[model samples]
Target chain A: MTGPGQMLRRPLNPYLAALVSAVVLIGTLALAIEQRAAILRDGREILLKTEPVDPRDLMRGDYVRLGYTDLSSIDETLVTGPWPDRDTTIPVWLTLAPGEDGAFVARSASFSRPETVAAEEVVLKSLPVRVTVAQPSGGLNAIGRLEFGIERYYVPEGEGLEIEKAQNQGRTTVAVRISPDGAPQIARLMIDGETLYEEPLY
Target chain B: MLRRYLSRELDQWTRSGLLAPGQAQVLLADHDRRYTGFSLSAVLAVLAAVLFGAAVIALIAANWEVIPRATRVIALLILLMAGLAAAAVAVRRGAPWVAEAALVFTLLCYGAGIALVAQMYHLSGDETGFMLTWAVGALVVSFAFASAMAAAGAGLLGFGYLLAVQDLFSGSGTNPQDLSSYATVLALAFAVGVAAWRSRSAIAGHLSALLLISWVMWVIFETTELEPGYVLAALGAVAFGAGSFTPSPLTGTISRHGAVSAYGAVMLLSGLGLIQVSLVDPGLGVEMALAAFILVVSVAVLAVAGGENRLVRRFAYFAFACETLYVVGETLGSLLGSFGFLFLGGVALAVMAFAVTKIEKRFKKGEARP
Candidate 1:
């Protein structure tokens, strides 16, 4: 045992161990909470129409699985900039604008963040999606899938099916707040233009 | 088990006049004192903590609506703090086992708290991220308290993170383009190695070694079109060389557990077995050559470290027997049909049994001398 590990064999003072553990654990939790809270408080808000499915998570209870309209699968022609060389997941910048139903829809996308967009359009960052198929005509024809990290709306046990039903009927929409970095956080859940649950900044 | 065996052996030795009656009691007492850290009470305490932690996690998963989300968060935080406080108190009272159990409880609470918050805020993160965060928390605890249990926990969680990222279990090889994922796992494994060393946990040390081996295998499979069996064999040869030939001081810590030699033997045998299976229609020449190579390697391993290392010796004997049977089946079975194959197999095994008896005697003699 005579090695670097040997050098570290002396246990920390019990009180010191306790203090350090508290600070690290508490700080991590607080940071996670604050990051989401900041986005909820100060980021741009937009409502997007969604289709929901239901699934139960072992650790996180029942939840509605959401698929945003026109966001999960974007037209390849809308992609601007050079595509990745290999089939791998890469973040794409999506520019969103209000559609006829007042829910935001993706207008265009790019491999890199757009330098500018129309005054009414807001740019949102997409979770990394695998580029599955590329067209010879300088556009991505198909991607594995896109995610915004707002796909799942955790709900009380056994209640996810109701929201899933509403969403499948084209009646459910999600209000999401996009931080400056293009990360989107769920701000509220809505059904038929009425807020069902509003998130509180903790 | 060790204590029981030692107790029985001590009594037998005393009765046989190998030790005086009172000397046996002194020896038993010394053994008990030295191994108190790993007593049954400690194991039971840790098990109880694990059960309690699981209950807390289940409560969070139930998403109990009676308590508001914010209140639930506060309660979890309080629980985590209280667990840490208890660990400190246990340490102060000189109850190391209780302190370790408390630390394990707190780490579990931290993970459950993460799950609870993720659920409450509707955060859509993958399992890899969740496991990585939990592992990092466990690492912090390990370092803070110098707790071996916490280090082992971190190692397990790190393994979970690796599993979540790669479909390794599905037998679909890793995505070659995702080198970053493997690198991250390697880094985490290295961190676990350091933590294991710091905490002096043999279990964690073994885990870290296995993790590194797994990463190498993943990379080899991903990056190369060549036979993974051959690659693994070469790697194992190198490891075996290092483990057996590396001079003391350099190999002191690693060889203390004889892990390197054992893992090397495992890889070597597994690689050879893979080659044997992969050769679906190999000509007689190739099959015989592979069998000879396998037999040679097994013997070499046995001759090198088998005298001292029981694990390596067992693996060597297993590999030798399997390769012998395989060669017999492949060559003689094809020529003579089932009846002759059975006769030849029995004769070969009987001969092998005689040789193994001799080898075992030699090994015992070597042990006795040392």
Candidate 2:
């Protein structure tokens, strides 16, 4: 420990250490960049959001206040069973017909697959959106690691900083996609999403 | 023709005598049995583990409350013990899956307890008990198993606890009375955490840092009540001290988080202190001494910022910048302040040049550290 400063770094290597360090640093940087990119890409989810639910999480603070994409104008009658409430993050199958808005209105939702639908049932991804610590109060709107049939929750930093803040502050707003069957899947958080700070009433 | 052809082939094979099928067939069968048996079982074992994992999650969610609090705690401890046993068995028997399963369950249970508390208490301001429990439990598990994840979790839990209890530390009135006491507690916490860190236990550093930082901030916030000026004086010294210890991430980070507030307060207090000194208030000598001490700290900070650590240098540079800004703003605000601006500007520019030159020197030195 030449200067007491060297004491900290004595455990690491010397000559090839920089190369190893660079790899480690770059790998971490890439992940961070990827996380930020994910939030930036899906920024539009802010506009599509509809429902708000509170989830008690430690990393992201006390609750997961969230909203979902609004399908208010979609058909309500074709729906089947209850949606995932505060209970589960289960898959909710749905079939939607093209509405006047050009968006597929959800025709039905169920735990089991629908046998037939007048309109083609487009299989949509139901993801559990979470407020990552890195981008607390924001979302990395990227095409997640999993494209469909999976939810993506990002870890903001090596240790969750922003998420902890939000959890402590109760400012992290997460959005979930609720199928007509009442089953809910996490969509995205309101952290970086273009939405107001408040929880959506619906 | 068929008889002749068969006879010729039979004669050739009999002559070769190397066309025996039974030995090769038996060897192939034995190999198949060896490879297929283990591979199939491995696949099945993984599938079974996944199913069990799913069931564990389901059970926790379904009967979250049916399992008593005490039972969950005991189960977590048992699971941790089981995980260690499994790891040991795996190491001994060469069965990696067994150990992996045990570890996963222990980790999950350790994490789940905190989540359960948050759920049980509705996780509002009133959920302090839950936070404390999670933090403590996580700390125990982390140290017991030397698990980094658990330690980090504990650290986060500790931070959450401080935030939840900020009211107690925030203090009331204008005097920051509890600083010395709070600092002592933080120091003790840091000592314990360091021991844990040295042991390579999870969450030790995190927990230690979380406590230390929150305590420092709380102390600053609390102490500001007595005389907001002391915070700047103390924090500025540390920031400068940080600059002195360049290329250290710990020091760098500490300076940023701790000294940022200190620097802000320094500028405000220094300007105000200068004005008070000029006025010659009866007890102004004490204030003047404090101001001089602060100036020494700033000079030290400049020297430290001369180091290679980006965080340290940035903070030191920011401190200097803030100091200059404070002098300029304060002088402009006061009638005589304008007259001293020229002198201050010269000193500030000189400091900046010195810092720039040190940058090259610092980088060269940095290249040598391991």
Candidate 3:
């Protein structure tokens, strides 16, 4: 090993540099794989209700923008506790319960995790989203919006339009695998209880 | 090119009995033995490596769903290991270009693997997250290998990360006034600039400079009510003044060059011109004043650094020429006035050309005296 200045003066050992490069590449791949495998193996399964909007990502290709009914459009009615009235990069926990159609819906949402949980209730977590309360209506029941990271369902190219069309007819549902840590992964896209696409955990 | 010119001069010197034939041959040999540029084989080897890397990425993006997830991961691991092993052998064989290119392929595989895993696992991340990961990986590789190509990649990825951050942070439905994300971009630009400087890659350094300047302008626009064009003009003026007139404390800490002065002069002139265009009501008086200031600055920069700094000279010439055309476009209200200005401009240019020729002769005579 050399001093940082001396390292710049002379060329690095190619073998060592190459070895470090290989370790980083393999390490990233392994970490991603292990993370996904944990979710797929030990995570609980739940059915999330979603409506689709057409969108495209340049790198990941086309996707049916998954607009979760419970998470995408959180209102004052769903929130059980005091909502944050300023900009925050904090996760809000939503306790989930089975709705009329046996699909999971938000029973109570809070900026902090609820201490008590019912026997049949599950909790889903959101990624860090900025929550801002409008100035005039900064009250307990202020109608504020929430954004969750589990918003997009990437599909193969040219398959988004069909999903959106089916979603328009109220025939689409998302099967999500919630990790033990409350992180949700989109597992499958179901149209009329038939599996359209099942995601592979790499 | 330098070697050829010097070799010819040495031949003439030898013929004129300024040096012996042995000394001329020795000088030519010394010059020829020095490693000045990459060989054709080295260039082609790097090109081949880049093409192969692109192919690997495309193969992964094809998303062979039929393959088991474990199998795809294993395959990528194997490819990554193989690339490193081959690079190691290339290093031993003294093929530095091949070694560097293999490292590039390894880095590309790392990115493709990350994207593939995200796609397979249905991970909820945006382009910003993806770009940050890729850029950090490239930067680490750049540092480890001291690779110029990797440094360039890191610089480009840093820019992509900045753009993605802007897109992701702004339209997140909440916190529309969150300008704090710019701090992350500033930090990224500084790191990439350091990597570029460490690699001694001029192209990456230029890209990083552009990134830093753009970030400054963005911060000025977001935080203050000042017009960015005017602020940029003032910034460029300060940078040029500092680099040219003041002794840089960075002379011992880092390399110093006259290029900073040239870069600053270009930015100052361009920013000033842009500010004029951004003016809402630039009246005739203001327009004429602006025109005069631009002309004076252009000439002053040309006279100050025109001999040593080619970039400054070129930008000054461009600004001067463009301002002259702009003045003609603005003052040409009547046909008679247009003809009169055209005649005046012609005479002025002729006199300027005579002065330039005289200066050129003086410079040549001064050089001949040495």
Candidate 4:
């Protein structure tokens, strides 16, 4: 019981209270930021020559699901090997060698050696690099509220919902990086090969 | 004394017209006058038997569709009738033993009905409808019979319903098990409290507070690798913090449990988040900043606001120390690691051991003195 004597004995520290609340707010924000950076820095990957499909969600808004090319034959543990630079299936940059058909294909990954015995056909397996993206413009053209950790990007729900409407009538194809999570929760959203919606879970 | 308290609370019902003033007067007089030859403990035992019997049997009945539906329905109705008769006898007599037995039997009837419904609807996984159904019946019985046990059963049923909704319906994004679940459960608990408070039953108030605290601790201390239950953790922290200041034993117990839980959960979550952040994306300066802020503020508030309350102060102190250690460890990972993580772990174990010993000694000495 807080007796009258005890209640009147002390005053609380305002600076401490403010500091704690500030810390909670800042911590929440920073955790958010670090998560974004992880999505940007490590959680994303490039899938060359892929397709996009619009998916509808009854819960948690709406978005698109991206289907990327399959990666078979991975070392499972990429800590050391020819792809020594590879870490978790997180994203990095990769340059695609294009063909006349506009379908860019590659013989090997950026991390593969050029100094090996002889040059042979290398069908682009796994690229140990991040893919550079084209940024879009205008509120009319932007994807909004994109989430879900699909490799390259998760379709933003706002724009994703809108696109889901359009794509229900049609389908679009775009290159995407698929996370090892069976599906990337949401790395970023893409539109017409442009990086639009993006985020990373730390 | 109990009669007077009950009359005061019962007055509200009379005013609200749920009971006639005459009926209220009669009930109050009867409660004061009757001697059921049954002790309160015996009544409580009967009530427990009824609730447990009903819940268990209902769960059994849930799978009893192989029997004819008509037969099942008939059996359920029979159970309900028996329960109602038992309740009538208990109410008319005003004996705690009979009241408890009646309440338990009624609960059994409720449970049987729940089973039949589950069987009928083939309700798999989601237990909300069952709990909701039971809660409504229990509520009616509690008010009609003025049974605290009935109120408690209803509260538990309602709490279960909340848990089911969150567990069965949470989405893929924005963790369902986070602060939202705790919020929902707490709201339900508060409603139960109000119901109990209106009854002016100490038993009701005590039970409500006890359950509320447990839920608070559960919310605050959940630290699975699942990552995001922390939102609940924050809400729980606030809830428990508020709870600690209340002048109720039920609330006090919850506060102590919740404070310790929140402290432990934050420790685990922070460390896990850090390791994950580093492994996935190293050098996360902002993550550190955010974690630090949450730690410093929560500890400070508990400490400064809590003042001389030994339990609250002790919990706050622990949180402060733990978070400080986190910062220190993160800042001096190399130094700690050079001595080895195992070595640090050993030191932690030793410190804990010493603290435990000192606490026991103090407790023993205090007891001896008294």
lDDT of 2 by residue, B83-137 (tens): 4455445535655445334434444554454443333222222334445555655
**TM-score of chain B taken alone, every candidate:** 0.87, 0.46, 0.84, 0.52
Show where candidate 2 strays beyond 4 Å.
A1-202, B1-108, B114-126, B168-188, B200-207, B216-224, B235-299, B304-311, B322-359, B362-370
- Please give the distance, in angstroms, between residue B140's alpha carbon in candidate 3 and its true position after superposition: 1.6
> Each prediction's DockQ?
0.54, 0.01, 0.42, 0.01
Q: Which ten residues in a row have the lowest lDDT in candidate 2 chain A?
A: A141-150
Measured against the true structure, the TM-scores of the candidates, in listed sequence, are 0.90, 0.35, 0.83, 0.39
Clashes of each: 0, 55, 0, 35
lDDT of 4 by residue, B99-156 (tens): 5565667566656655544333222223554566566666555555555666777687
Candidate No. with top DockQ = 1
lDDT tens digits, residue span B147-241, model 3: 67778888888889878766545434334234456776787788778778777778778878888988887666655678877887788887777
RMSD of each: 3.6, 25.9, 4.5, 21.7
**Stretches of candidate 4 above 4 Å error?**
A1-202, B1-71, B84-98, B117-127, B167-169, B172-190, B198-295, B305-311, B317-370
Give, for candidate 4 chain B, the lowest lDDT window spanning 10 residues.
B117-126
Better structure of 1 and 4 per TM-score: 1
Write out the backbone clash pairs for model 1.
none
Instruction: Tell the DockQ for candidate 1.
Output: 0.54
Local error of candidate 4 at B169, Å? 4.4
Error of 3 at A83 (Å): 6.9
Instruction: Give the DockQ-based CAPRI class for model 3.
Output: acceptable
